[model samples]
Target: MRIIVYGSLRREQGNSHWMTNGQWLGDHVIDGYELYSLGHYPGVIKGMGKVYCEVYRIDATMLAELDALRSKGGEYKRELTSTPYGSAWLYVYQHSMAGRKRIVSGDWLQRDKES
Candidate 1:
């Protein structure tokens, strides 16, 4: 199954992070997702605007696992949406707080400045 992930989950190395066990989808920057900063942590509000995602190609098993995780949290959600890949699932950011925010960077294979 293919999935689109938009938010801090973005992996600078791949579309998906091994930590999440999700296959890397791709790199993309979409808006409409609400931004709610929780100190060091943050959340996004989906369906708020025109949020785009960095897609990743992953196995169905992994997708299901991630789906479950997203559902468990108020900050993330797996929504049934259409994508270029086909009828797939997408995780959008749910704003837990309130604030006008912008993503400074995400996983894009360009490499994090930390390196």
Candidate 2:
């Protein structure tokens, strides 16, 4: 299965260890969404800008582990979404972005310096 990761799960980020077995498929951009700052990580919501992400191909075991890591407090929900690489699972933020800062550039790595 393929997964689109836009935050800590990307290469060199804090939680990237979970993807050690996965194949890096390079960077990608998903349109019609925006990235926002949720303190330590980023969140995506439906909006006008593109959301930059990294794609990865992983096996079932890796998928399960990722699901567990992401689904735990319901802060995010995995959904099948379309990307330039085809259909992939994307973790959409579940809570509100009420007072959060929007990552205008749409790339998590670029937003890091602003933190």
Task: Kindly list the per-residue Cα lDDT of model 2 for residues 3-89, writing each as its tens digit.
Answer: 999998889998888888999987899998889998888889788999889999889999899888878899888888876677899
Where does the lowest 10-residue lDDT sum fall in candidate 1? 106-115
Worst 10 residues of 2 by lDDT: 106-115
Which of the numbered candidates is closest to the native, going by highest TM-score?
2
Error of 1 at 9 (Å): 2.1
Q: For each candidate in the order shown, give its overall lDDT on alpha carbons.
A: 0.53, 0.88
TM-score, predicted candidate 1 vs. hidden true structure: 0.55
- List TM-score per model, in order: 0.55, 0.91
User: Tens digits of per-residue lDDT for model 1 on 6-113?
Assistant: 545565423235436665555455554543434333444553544446567678777667767666756566666666656556655654444543333432222234
Where does candidate 2 stray beyond 4 Å? 113-115
The runs of at least 3 residues in candidate 1 whose Cα sits more than 4 Å from the true structure, single-residue gaps closed, are 13-16, 19-25, 28-32, 39-42, 46-48, 93-96, 99-115
Q: Give the per-residue Cα lDDT of candidate 2 at 43.
A: 89
71, model 2: CA deviation in Å?
A: 1.0
